[model samples]
Target: MIWNLSICFMSFIFLFLTSIFLMFLGVVFIFYDLCYFIEWELLMLNSSSIVMTLIFDWMSLIFMGFVLFISSLIILYSDEYMHGDFNIDRFIILVLMFVLSMMFLIISPNLISILLGWDGLGLVSYCLVIYYQNVKSYNAGMLTALSNRVGDVALLMAIAWMLNFGSWNYIYYVSVFNDSFEMRVIGMLVLLAAMTKSAQVPFSSWLPAAMAAPTPVSALVHSSTLVTAGVYLLIRFNSIICDNCLGQFLLLFSGLTMFMAGLGANFEYDLKKIIALSTLSQLGLMMSILSMGYAKLAYFHLLTHALFKALLFMCAGSIIHNMKNSQDIRYMGNLVLHMPLTSICFNVSNLALCGMPFLAGFYSKDLILEVVSLSYLNMFSFFLYFFSTGLTVCYSLRLVYYSMTGDFNCLSFHPLHDEGWIMLGGMLILMVMAVFGGSLLSWILFPSPIIISLPMSLKLLALFVSLIGGFLGYELSKFSLSYDLQSLRYYLTVSFLGSMWFMPMISTYGVNYYPLIVGLKYYKVFDQGWSEDFGGQKIYNSSVEYSQYMQWWQDNDLKIYLISFMFWIIILFMFMVI
Candidate 1:
């Protein structure tokens, strides 16, 4: 008990202090737009400057505060949740490192400095994901690491390409960069980096697979910090990206990602995995909206979603802990009767996730839908946004029905007390935010409410989607439940949704298959066969033959030397006569 509690207690105190300091910074930056660059000119070439630079601005300070606040709560929650673990200290260290890496990412305005935080995030997250000594954790860590490395490579390329500008600092150039070809390339690469980090579209498989990590990692990684890194990059680069053709493509793909994740959540049965997919879906929402030239709104949603979603993960974690690590929803039901507080927190977060009235998600989500409705978007994007909204409601309700209501589904009963106040303590604070954070942020972010001129029918569209989705979710899960979903007629459709439209296969095998085969072929042909036969083996045989000939000539050294000398003399005399 002391082992676990002491780490959490110390971490919470440090983080709490850090959060307060960052909050003070955020307030200062917000009022004054604090912008400064500390430059160390290590070396200067004829036309370029290489320097270490750090930027302080409202975005960095505010984001840093939010990150510290959430991280502190998560660390505190892990005291009870991670109790009795053999390597709890290692977990605590990784979590703190995760927080530090994120702070680096938030503060840097230079691409080179950003990579420091970016790569740290990838490496630390991979370590945390594989913290458990299990095959599943190992595979998940590899997938997570490799998927993120694609982004790291992209960022490095962007950094190299940005050398044309002679400065690593990009904040100054964002407004005008879109006019140049090189900058456009950087923008596209930046978008790619963000997509992989946020698990947008084809890169989405790793987010759910990452659920193999401990839930505290999931709360921080998925809900707020790691996944949001890409969105933050896009938010910073919005000026350049929003004007590019790639931004339009981002809109299309992000919509697809949102719809895909929402649909996948509906078919998913694993409780933690379902919530992981929900996080993926919301990431799509943020990215797609950012692509539509609403970067601030997207950022606003990012903040509120982080609050509620972290709480959501904590609630789910508590349930899993109480259930002795059974994540299958089929084994859960009527949890509210036993774990009332957790159930309340879970329901509140779920409602907020669905954008229910006055909740944290409602503020940002409702605004997004309204603004998206008024924006001049294509049909595909419009449909995806609205339909995906409903799917969010559908999955939230389905999760509620299967796991929070109905009879006790588990074969054996355990004490369902919300006895872990250490875990619940963190959740309680987040719950307050989940209930009111949206309204508070909305007031601060948008001093005056945004007004949209839409017809009555269009204004009600969001409400309609939520109602229909909620009803369908309840009916399908309760009254009209059928076990024949695996019948011949329904099997294919069920399998498609169940498998997340086969995205896992496409992402895992589709991306890796050809490269792996090419690697094997190279190994066989060059390393084992052709290189040895034509290069090393041939050279060795020639050397052996020459050595043998030299040995034989040496055996008859006097005669051989005399004959060779006479032939050379005759040739030289003939040439002189000619």
Candidate 2:
């Protein structure tokens, strides 16, 4: 206990200090207009060499600082969150390794190094998801790992294609070869990898499924580490994707992802999965703008979204912990009466998520909406973006109504109170950031404010939809005993929307259905039927029978010795006669 607690304390201090230090370096790097690289040769072949390279610049440094800072607070949060678990030490180590892996991904411009971090995130996340040691956790972990493995395969292909360039540092060469078929293919593969990581469209099921993990891991994964890795990569490769066909492709799917995820979250009853789906929706918004050539705005949203989302997850974790680990929001109502502090933090973070005026999400989300309006894109995409924006607000308000308002529906003797001060301490810190992170990030990221000229109708459109969505969210949740639930009348539509448009089904059983069936057939035909006669088991039996037959010769060796002597004497007599 003492050792584990010490590890948490020590890590918080070390990482907290490092985050501040790196933040200072980030500002300095930006001020000086400087970048540095360190290369250590890992392998060399006649002309082509594989090198582990590290880059130091404002972007990587600042991103790393935020990641570590959140990780520090999460470490503090988890110390109390996983208090009595026998494997608390292991949990801490995994989280620390997760942070390190992210640092690896953030600092390296090399595809090879990024793969190290990418695969690490996938693997560590699987371990974290299954940390609970239950069937659901195991299944969710498999889904998460397999989904991420698709991205890994895509990245590996990208790396293989990069072999044509003689160096893996695409940062120095991608723009030069932007028109080349090779670079285009690499961009597509990178986008595919990004899609899987970011949980866009069909690959999105795993993000919500991963809610089976601990909330601290969810906070980290959703906020800064796993999901955002894809968006960050796209931001770096914005040069190649701008105005390209791949950008259009990303726009279509990201818009769909944003729309679908928001709709799904509104239908979801599980508290953590609702939050997880919201993360997916936010990632889609980021990707959609990046596709439209606003990488800075995407990155701006990424940083701000991280702050509130992390706070939101912490508050949810606290609620779940006190609610007897019940994640069902149906069991939670009138939480404001019992846990006033948490309710304050929860609503504030949710409002930030809804892009409430002057809040963290507002600065980024509103600016993104305005920028999309300014750009000339297809009408279909524009509709998806605005409607998805409304859905985001709709779900935020719906979740608030279901989980925070109404009557308390939990067990009569529920643990309906706030958590320890340690947990609240982390929540309070992030809550403050959720309020101010957007403006701070906007100032630091863009020295000069972005100005957009728009008509009054266009400018007020976001606000208008937000108000409408809020009304719908509340009205949809308000039910009397005689009220007809639309879900009952439209079962298929509700199920389709609620289940992430059958994406989980498609990603899980749908993709592997045929392969699993084929494996079953092979097992019946080869292992059970034909293999008995043709495979190793038959060979083993034949060898044993042959050995038994040879054993008789050994047993009769003494008797055969006398017969052999007589035969030899007769053969000698015949030879003499000849």
Candidate 3:
């Protein structure tokens, strides 16, 4: 008992203090435009050396600070959330290791060291996802692990490709070899790695499937650590992918990811999955703008999104805890009446996700949309950007409608209220940040105001779309038990939308089908057909027959020997007579 409380306190206190120090250093570095790199060579053979490197700049430091800050709060929150769990210490340690891996990825400029962090994230995330010890969790863990393995392979290939350059420090070569063919290959491989990590397009399935993890893990994984690791990598390697094949394709897939996740969230009933899809949507937004060569904007949004999304998950976690571990929003209604504080926190976080004006998401999401509108682009890209934005609002409002309003569908007179101040403390911290984080980040990130010269119609487009989306969300929610819901009426379309356009199925079964079919056919032709006649089966039959004859002869060994001796003697006499 003492050990459990002590570990949580020790981790939280240490990390909280460290995060504040790092944030202060980050601000100082940004103000002075400073960067420092430390390289340690472990092995030198001939002219090339295997070296590990860490880069400290404003970006890496600030991101590290945010990750640790969230981690600390989550550890504090977990003290209450997992109070009765058997493996509380193991859970806390895994969370710490997850944060450490992210820090490794954030600070490293070398591909080798970055991969160290990347693979650590994959490994730790698998452990966390399957922490539940259930069939569903096992499957989700496998999917998460395998989907991320694609990125690992891509990273390994990238490191192999970098061998020709006699260096693994990709930062030094990005600009120097931008147009070279070799660099292009490396850039594509890195982009592949980022896309899988960030859960863009086809790779997007695993993000929601990974909801099998505990909510605190969800908060960390979705908010700042695992999912964002890819986006952070892209931000670092942004120079290599700009205005090239990698960048253009990034836009396409990320836009699709955004639209798909937003649309999916609307139809999702599972509370955690909806939020997971929301995280996917935000990641797509980050990747889409990053594709347009706005790494700074992406980074800004990443930080702000991290703040609120963490809060959103924390609130959701509290609700789930109070509601007897139920996550279905359908069975939950009028929660505002029972869990007022949590409902308030949830609404605030949801609005922040929808990019409500003056919220943290607004500064970055709005800025990104406006900047993209300013650029010369095709209509499809433009529509995808805004429609996806509206979908974000749509699902958020729908979530509010389903979970906070209507009737109390929970158990009769079930007590669903705040348990203690500890969990609420963690949530309140993030809620405050969610409300003011954007403006704060905006002021610091952009010291000078961004003046956009746009027509009034274009300026109001975001607001107009958001209003329409909110209206649609309400319209979508007006149903009773008298008749079937529109979702049931249009089952197929809803399924298609709800299922991330069948990506999980396609990536899993669709990908497996052909290879498995080919293997089955090979087995039929070789193992069952030709091998049965000419290979191991036939050889086994012959060996069995010969062994049986030897056994019979051995059983009649004395009689057989007498017969053989008489035959040999008769043959010798016949030969002598001849």
Candidate 4:
């Protein structure tokens, strides 16, 4: 306990101090349009300069401050949550490593340096996910690691492609190489990397799977830092990606991811997975807006979402801790009666997630929706945005109804205590931010108000979705009491939504099944049969046959050797005659 406290104290001090410094930089950059750019020529490879550059513009500074701030708070929370665990030190170390990698990713403009941070996040997150050393944790860790590796591989390819530009400093080429074929390839590769890191579309399975990690890890990693890295990267590379065909594809897929995750969350039973899906939905929101050429707005939402989403995870952590590790919302009921503080925190975060009028999430989400509303979009993108917004409300209210309002449904007595200062401390800090972060950020980010002209119907669209979703969420959770919707007609629809539209299956077995079958055939044919039969066994048989032939040289009689030599000569002569 003492060691954990000491580490948390030290981390808090360091992160707070650094956050202040970065905030100062952000302010200066905002006012003066100044960037603190530093470059070091690390080495030269094939006369192509491999340099590391750090760019501290307002965006980087502010985002870094937000990440470090949330990380420090999460560390404080972990002290209580991970108490009595022998691997607590390892947990703290991994969390710090994640933060360090995020910082590395945030400041560096060079693709090579960013990979160092990018791969660091993947490796450390895998370690953290399986920190409990359970089978579920192991599986989750493998999925998380492998899914992110696709991004890592994409990043490596992007780096290799960027080598044609003579420097790995991609920010320099973001504007100038907009039309180059190599740059287009690099842009597409970077987008792929971002999609995986952000858990957009097909790579979305790993985000929910990764909830097997400790809650503090989830609060910091999935909710805030690791997941947002992709959106941040795109914001940096927006110059090259915003006008391309790939952007349209990204727009389409990201919208689908948002809707899919929101719909899936409505059917999800596990509390942590529900929150994880919410994170995925929000990630999709950010990516979709970015695809539509609103990078700053996407980044703004990323920051606000981090603030409240981290609190949401912490509140879920508190509830999970109080419920004796029960993460199933079906097993929880009327938590507000027992854990009032946690309930409040959870409610605030959820409302923020739903983009309640004045909360942190509202500023960014509303701006995103307005921008999206005004943009030139087809019906597909339009439906995805509006309907996904409703689904967000549907799931948020469903979670509230299941866990906060019904009777306490636990099988055993579990005392819910709100006096864990370490736990509540983090929640309280973020709750305040979740309450006020939107207004604060809006004031800072947009000194000039953004003006949008929309029809009254379109302006009320978000409100309509929220109201309808809330009503449906309440009604649906109580549907079993009054309806027989579980009949054969509805079974497939329920199963599909309940199974997250089989995304997990598609991302997992659907992707790996054929490759695995092919591997098995290779094992059977080459590894087991052909390789041994032709490779090793054939060599051995040939050697044996040579040995048998050479046995003629060891014949007991000189006459035998003379006969053999005569036979060999006769064969040679026959060949010559032919």
Candidate 5:
């Protein structure tokens, strides 16, 4: 007990020290804002000379706070959660590496540094996902690595294009090429990279697969770190995306992803998988908000989402841990009775996630809706926002009902106790923020000067819609929805067909990978021809065949060696003569 208490105390000390360092970093970032506002060209240029200059910006500070907060929570949770687990040292190392990479990623001032951090985060995440190295975890890690490679390639292409056609410095590159066609292309490519990284739309399947990993990894990656990379990219290049077609594309794609992921979450039985789907949906909503020229709103959502989502995931982790690693929601029921503290934390986070009034999600989600409503690009975007909100409520309620409220039926699984005080302490901190985040935002975070006033009516309307939607979902949840196999089949077929068409469009236009199809055909032909000529199965069967052939060759080896040597000598002599 003394050792355990000491460990928990040490973890808290580490987190507190880290938070102080991050706060100092945030203060340093304010100086960059000053330099940018003053138009100090010399300061701007020389700022690139020093690595510390990367720390100077409001955006970087905001994201850095996000990284620090989420990472600290995860670390604290892991202190107890991973107490007796083997490979604890490796887990802690990977967790620290993940946090360091994300810190560097948000603060990097140049594309090269950003990519370095980006790849580092990907590498560390891959390590964490397959920490156990079981077959399923290994396969999940491989898929994650491949998807991240795709995102990295797209990001590299965009960086290359920017270097060739625009400036190389982060702010300069965005400002100098703000109105150019190449900038638009770069913006679109960056969006594609972000989509893949954030698990948007067709690229979203890997996030659920990632649930095969440990819950701590899921909490870290999905809740706060890797999944937010795309949003960070967008936020970094907000100026470039604001006046381009890429922004419109993001709006549409994000809205669609939100709706689709929400629908999928309603059908998911796995607790972590449902939370994974929620992450995708919320990220889509964030992207859509960013698309509508509301960087502040998007950032607001990002901050709130990180807090509540991390809390939810950690609480889910605690539950899973209690249940001896069972992830199926069907096996979980009356958990509130079994684990009251976790139940309260989970419910609080879920309420925030559902955008209940006065919660963190409520403020940011309403703000996003308000921004979209005011912009009102078209009927499609408007209706998409409405539908997405309704679906968000539907899935949020679905998760809460399925996981917490059902009758306890599984006797084979023993009732487990709550997490340690340290775990509960971390959760309680997040829960307080989740409940009071909106008030904090309004009272402190919003711009003081108020250069532009938001639409009051639109804000009110969005809040009303969100509240009504949640109520509707609660009512709908009173009766179980009947499952129709035929309807499910039809929906699956349509989704698959739509994705088939949609993938090509997004790849060709959004991602700018039109040559992929041609490359696929060429690869197919190459594979087929290789298989036909090689007698594919015979190679594995014929290790001794090579030995026999080698023996036969030995009989003629002297003659063949002489001929080969002479041929090489002749070629060399001819080259020397020439």
Candidate 6:
């Protein structure tokens, strides 16, 4: 017992030290990149000698910095939030494990290492989700694990297919698979995995369930780590996907997920769940950009989203913590007055999420919209973007309004204050990034001196649509619009018809459905008759019959064994002669 305790203590110390070390390394790397940004040759030469070549890229650096920054903040936040709580040590260990896995993931050279890191993250996240050991938390963790498993299987199949085709390395895979039919299939499979991981479309139900985790875990995993894996995957394989039908499919699916999830966020009341759904929506937008072959825009969105979303989630956590575990936004109001610093940080991040002009999200989102406009695809994508942007505005404002603007009704038992200097320190850093990350990144990547301009007409249109959506949502909230809408019914009907229309094609080319049908029929038969009817009859009938048979077999056992041995000897001799 003493040895085990010592080992645990040592692990905690190691993690705490590593967190600080990586954070320092990350800041230094960022500064290094910034200095080298002015001279491309120097940057390239320096990168060549770096221990991890994969982490040398500007995109990797950006994401790594975000990861380190937020993770360090989370560690500090956990110190206060989890103080004196049972399992605090274990929680810190898991947090360290999660951060280490993400760092490895950011710098992994190939798919194998990436998968290891990815799966490690999934495991740690599951642990954190069920850290409290409550039934609800357990169920949520199970569902998340199952969903991630499906994605993992898809990823494994894609990796195997790539290796079989002699494209094992990341760069080689992209170059070789650009024009191959097998590559297209592999890309689609990867996209499926990405979709599930990012909580897109029909696979999105697990994200809200994941809210059962502790607030810090929710903030860290949902925003900066787990959900972003799919976006990272999409960005990593953008070249191969862009050259295939998978790109178009991704565009459609991503746009659809964004629109749908934004709507869901608009309707959700749980603060953490709202942020969870928003993460899904924002990730969908990022994926759509990647699908369009705009790798720079996608990475920019990833960086900016990480900053703003993490801040927003952490701020939400502070509010919930102050409210004594109440996450319902209805119970929260006038927090702007009570927690002034937090309110500013939260509102700034919220505006950034709303794509307000000159903020981080605006730059990234506008770039994507611009690229989408230039794409040769159908107009449906454009329409989806327009509608999604409006919905994004509505949900983003919903968060601000419900938590910061409404009347203060809930009585405070304890005086509310902003979280400690350590937590606020993290939020302040993110706030700075939320203000400037996009502009700095764009300057680094875009060749020639590109002017940073927020077009007045575009701003006006976005703001007008946003205000309309927000106002409408506010008005609608006054009434319980609980009745099922005809539009939703139509959506379901069309979706069913679409599935039916594709069934014949799937049956002919995809996996065989005959065996599945047969198995279902057999299961129904057994469930209805054999098990049910036999259980209702004498329960000992089969046992008695089997016992009698066993006694008869025992009487003849010696004779049977002798005959079987003789038959085996003769067969063995015959086979040898042949």
What TM-score against the true fold does each predicted structure earn? 0.89, 0.89, 0.92, 0.91, 0.79, 0.77
- Give candidate 3's TM-score: 0.92
Residue 47, candidate 6: Cα error in Å is: 30
Q: Give the TM-score comparing model 1 with the true structure, all chains together.
A: 0.89
What does candidate 2's lDDT look like per residue over 189-221, in tens digits? Answer: 999999999999889999998998899999999
lDDT of 6 at 172: 44
Residue pairs clashing in model 6 are none
Q: What is the C-alpha local distance difference test score of each model?
A: 0.89, 0.90, 0.90, 0.88, 0.75, 0.74
Instruction: Please give, for residues 1-578, the per-residue lDDT of candidate 5 as tens digits.
Output: 45554554565577557765755665455534532222222343544632333644666765676677777777778878888875666677778788888887887767767888899988988888888779988977877787778889998998888776544556656767678788777877888888888877678766777788778778888766899988988887888887867778788788888877776666567899888888988998988888877877787788888889989989998998887888887777888888889999999898788788788888788666765666657988887787778777776776677668877646776657788887888889889988986667554456453333567765566556666666766676567555464697655644443243244345335543457776777777766656644767457558678888877887778899678879999999999999
Maximum-TM-score candidate = 3
Ten-residue stretch with the least lDDT total in model 1: 480-489
For model 1, give the RMSD to the true fold. 4.5
* Clash number by candidate, in order: 0, 0, 1, 0, 2, 0
What tens-digit string does per-residue lDDT give for candidate 3 at 131-225?
A: 99999999899999999999999999999999989888888877888888888898899999998999998888889889999989999999999
Better candidate number, 1 or 3, judged by TM-score: 3
Candidate 4, residues 1-578, lDDT tens digits: the string is 67767887788778867877887778678878887889788898898875678988999999988888888888888888888787777777888888999999999988989999999999999999998889999989999999999999999999989878888877876799899999999999999999999999888889999999889899997666889999999999998888789889999999989988988888789999999998989999999889888888998899899999999999998888878888999889999999999999999999999999999999899889888888899999999998999989998999999999979898585576774987888789899999998898888888887799999998989889889988898888886533258776455566677667788888888889989999999999999899989898899999999998778666666788888889999999999999
Model 4 ranges off by over 4 Å:
41-51, 481-491, 526-578
Model 3 scores worst on lDDT over the 10 consecutive residues at 480-489
Candidate with the larger lDDT of 3 and 4: 3
Collision pairs in model 4: none
TM-score winner between 3 and 4, please give it. Answer: 3
